[model samples]
Target: MEKERNITSMIAAGLLALAAVVGAPERALAADGAALLAANCLSCHSAQGGSISRVEGQRKTPEGWQMTITRMQEQHGAKVSAEDKRRLIKYLADTRGLAPAETAGWRYLLEHDNNRVETIDGRYRDMCARCHSGARFALQRRSEDEWKLLMHTHIGLNPTLEFHSLARDRQWFPLAVNEVAPALARDFALDARAWKAWQAAPRTALDGSWRIAGFLPGKGAFEGRMRASAAGEDRYELAIEGRYADGALLSGRGVATVYTGYEWRGSVDIDGVALRQVMAADARGERMHGRQHFADSRRMGGALSALREGAAPMVMAVMPAQLRRGETAELTVVGSGLAGAVSLGKGVRVLEVVSRSPDRVVVRARAEGRDGLNDVAVGSARGKGLLAVYGRVARVEVEPANAIARVGGPGDAQMQKVGVAYRAIGWAAGRDGKAGTADDLRLGYLPARWSIEAADEEAEKAHDADFVGHIGADGVFVPGDAGPNPARPKSLGNTGRVNVVATVEAAGATVEGRGKLDVAVPDFVQRALD
Candidate 1:
C-alpha cells in the first residue's frame, strides 16, 4: 500500500508539472511577436484574428505582461528562455501599452522612485491592492468582460485568497465581481481610438548624442553621455562614456529596443558587468528617465536619466543614495552643468566643498541623526537629487504581512520546498503614528536573520517542525513530505501555519519582526472554479 501511494504521488506530481508548463510563456524564442505566438501558443490559445484572440484589444504595462508570463509559466507550464521572455515582453508592451493621453496623470509615479504609499479607493482597495501594488492596477486598460475574466481567474485559482487576513473581514468575491470589476473597467477601460492613433503616430528618431546622469549606490554618482544611431524601426545602437565622482573615466555600449512608443529596453555591459536598462522617453522624445541594474545582483543599482543635446542642466544621480545619521561622509553628485556650490538639503550640513565641476561634485557633509530620507538640491538646478539620513533602526516590518508555502509530496522532486522571500523593512519611529508617513524615517533594506516556527503551542506540541520542514537564512521555507505525518493526531497531513521571523541589530539593540506563513500540500492544479 505504501508503494502504491508513492507511485500515485509521483503521477500527481507529473501532472502538476505538465499543468504549470502549459501555463508558462511561449517557447518560440522569436523577435516577431505575432509569429512567435502563432507558432507556439496558437496550438492551445488559438488565434482567430491577426492576434491571439484572447489577448486582443488588451493593454498593460511591461510589469503586467511579466506577471502574465510568470503566471503562464507557474500555472500553465509555458517554457521560454530569459532572453526570449524579454523580447516577448517588449513586443507585448509596445503593442499594448497605455497611450500618453491615457497615462497623463499617472506618468509621474513611473518617472519618480519615491517610497510613498499609493492610495486606492473602495472595495477594490480591500480586494486588490492588498495583493499587488496600486501601480499594477493603474497601468492597464481592459474591457468590462476582460476584467470580469480576470476576477474569475483569481477566484478559480486561489479560492482561499479572500479568506486571507487582508480580506477576511469583507465579502471579497461578491464585492469584487459586483463592484470592483465594473469600477475598474469603467475607470481604466481600453481607449481603442487612442491606441489606434498612437500606433500611427510618428516614432521617435533616437539618433544622436544625449547627456546622461545617474547614480549607482555604493559606487557613488556618475555623469556620462550616450550616442545612439538607428538600428532599425524603434531600435538603436548605443555607446556610452562617463566619469565617476572620483574622476574615473567609464565607457560601455549596447543595443536598445523601444516599446510602448516611448519605453526603452536596453542590454548593455558596464565596466564588463552585464546591465539591463528600463527607461522611458518623454512625450517629446528629448528626455529619458528610468533605472538600470546589474543582471546578476539587481539590488546593486540606481536611478538614471538622459537629456537631448543643448538641453538645460539635469541632475542624473547622487551616489551612495542615502546617508547614515550622525556620520560624516563624502558625497558625489553627478549631472550636467552642475557648477556652483551644492546644497545638501535638510538634516545634513555641508562641511566643505571638496571639488566641483560641470558634471561632478564631491562634498564633505554630516547627517543629523533625526532626519529621514531627504531631497538634496543644487542652487538653481533643473533637477532634484535625493539623500536619506537615518539612525539605527527602531523597528522592522515584514512586508505582505502574510505569505503561503507548500509541502512537497513523496516522489515529487519539484514539490520539495517552497521558497519565501523575507525582506526586512527598517523603520525609525516618527512623530506621527504611521511608519511610512512623512515624519517617520524609513531605513530601507536592512540585513536580517530568518527563521520559522509553529504559530501556537498546539502546533508546537505536534512537532510541526518535523513536518513543516525549515526556512533558510535566504528566506526560503521548505516543507516536509505531503502524506500524513506520524507526528500528530492521526498525522494530520503535512499542513499548518508557522511564523516567519526576521532579526536585525541596530543601535546595539536587537529588533525582531514577524510575518505569518501557511504551509500546505501542493495545490498547483485548480480542482474546480469557485
Candidate 2:
C-alpha cells in the first residue's frame, strides 16, 4: 500500500484516469473490509451495533474517512496499521461513500481551492463555517441524530463552542441542537437517491491508455498519455509521459485508486517531483477531470482533463488559449480521437498543418479582425472557446487578485518558503467598447512589467518592498528568509503587506493592473484536507 500523506490538491492535480477494472471487486465488498474495521474500530464503535453502527449511518468521501480514522487515533486512542487503514478506507468509500452528485457545489473543498471566498448561506456560515471550513462539513452526510451526535462531540471536545463570538450572543446550544441539526440533516441527509444510483451503476474500469490535457495556471498547457495497469486488488500503477506547451517533457510514475466508482486519487512523481492527482472520472470512466498539485506546496498546481485512448472524439485544450487579431501564431490543438481538417472558427484561418496526430495537431493560424472566443474543432469534436482571439487590449487584469506568500523559515522544518506567481491578463473591450465592464473579452496572459508597492504608509515605514520579497523578471515574488532582521526596527522577520502591480504595453500605451499580496508566516498545522 502507498503511504497516505496529508494531501489535498488544487482543482488540477494532474490527470490520472483509466478503464476502471471494476465488477463488484472483492476489495469493495463491505464484508471483509468490515472485518478490518471491526478489528480497529469495534473496540469503541462497539457501543452501537458492536461493529459498525455509527459508521453505517453516515457516508463520506475517502478523505473524510481518512480524517475520521486519524481523529479516532488522535482523540480515542484507536490503533490500526497503515495498510489496514488504507483497505478500510477504500472499503467504506466504495460501499457507503457520498455519491458524486451529492458532492457537487463543494468540489472546490476537495480540490483545495484555498483562495476561494465561499458564499455559504448565513445560517451555515455563522454556525458552522465560522469555526472551520464550510466545505469540511458540506462533504459529509448524516442523519439528524448523527448531526446531533457530531454537535455533542464538538461541544464535548471544545466546551467553549457555544461561547465563541458567533455563538455567545444567542442561545447557541439550543439553536444548534434544534434548528441547525435538523436543517443539516434535511439538506445533507444520509439517504439519497443519487447514492443508490451510484452503487447500482457499473463502476469505471480504469486500466489501459489515457490521453491528458492538463493546464497549470501560471505554467501553461501540458499534453500527455498515461498507461495504467493493475497493481493490486483495487489499485493501479500508472506511467505518465507528455510535454508542456513549450515541448518540455512531462513524465511520471504513480498509482491511483477509484473510490465510490468515480473518485480518482493518486500520486505521480513527475520529473522526480511528487504530485497528487485528484480527479472525478465520469460514470463510464471514459473521461476524467480534476487538478494536479505540487505535493508539499498545497497552494501551487494546475488543472487536468483527460480522455481514455480510443474513446470518443474530444478536444482537450487549444494551446495559446488566446490570440490577437490580424496576427498569425503557431497553435497546438491537443485532444484525442481527432480526425480530418482542423478549424479555428470563423475569424481564424488555419494557414498550415505543421504536424498532426490523434492527440496533438500543430497549426499556423491567422486571426481575422473579428474578436471573441473561438471553438477549436477537430472534425466532429469541438472544444468550446478553447481559443480566444481579440482585436486590441482594452484592459489588463491580475489573476488571483488577493494572495498570501509564506515567509521562508530558512532551515526550519515547519516553516517553508512560499512563492507567489503573478500573471497579467489582457482583455479586449466587448461590443460596448469599454473596459472594466462585464463584457470584456479575455485575451489570455500578457507579458507584464511586474512591480510592488507598499499598500499604505505603515507598510512603507517598515521598508516592506525591500524586506518582504523581490518580484523577479518572471513576475514571481520570492520572499526573504524568516524573521529577526537585526538591522530593522524591533528585529522583525521578513513580513509585509503590499500591492502587486503589473503593467501591460497595449496599443502604444501601458495599462496597469494590481493585486494584493501578504508576505506572512507559515501555516503550522497541516491537515489532509484543507
Best by lDDT: 2
After superposition, the stretches of candidate 1 with alpha carbons farther than 4 Å from their true spots are 1-96, 100-185, 192-229, 238-254, 267-281, 284-311, 316-321, 334-337, 352-362, 369-373, 378-385, 390-392, 399-423, 432-438, 446-504, 515-530
List model 2 lDDT by residue over 1-530, tens digit each: 11111011110121111112235446335555655665566455533323256887799999899989888877778888888889888988988799889988787667765656688878899999997788889899998999999988889989988878989999888888899999999889899889888888876678889988776644556889999898766688999999987788878899999887788898889888878888898888898888887787756666787788877787878877887777889998988878888999988889999999877889999988688888889997778887888877888887768888888678876678878666788888988888889988887777889999998899999989888988876677778898688867999888899999999876577789999888987665562223
lDDT scores for all predictions? 0.69, 0.80
Q: Residue 2, candidate 2: how far off, in angstroms?
A: 36
Tell me the lDDT of model 2 at 59: 90
Q: How does candidate 2 score on lDDT?
A: 0.80
lDDT of 2 at 470: 89
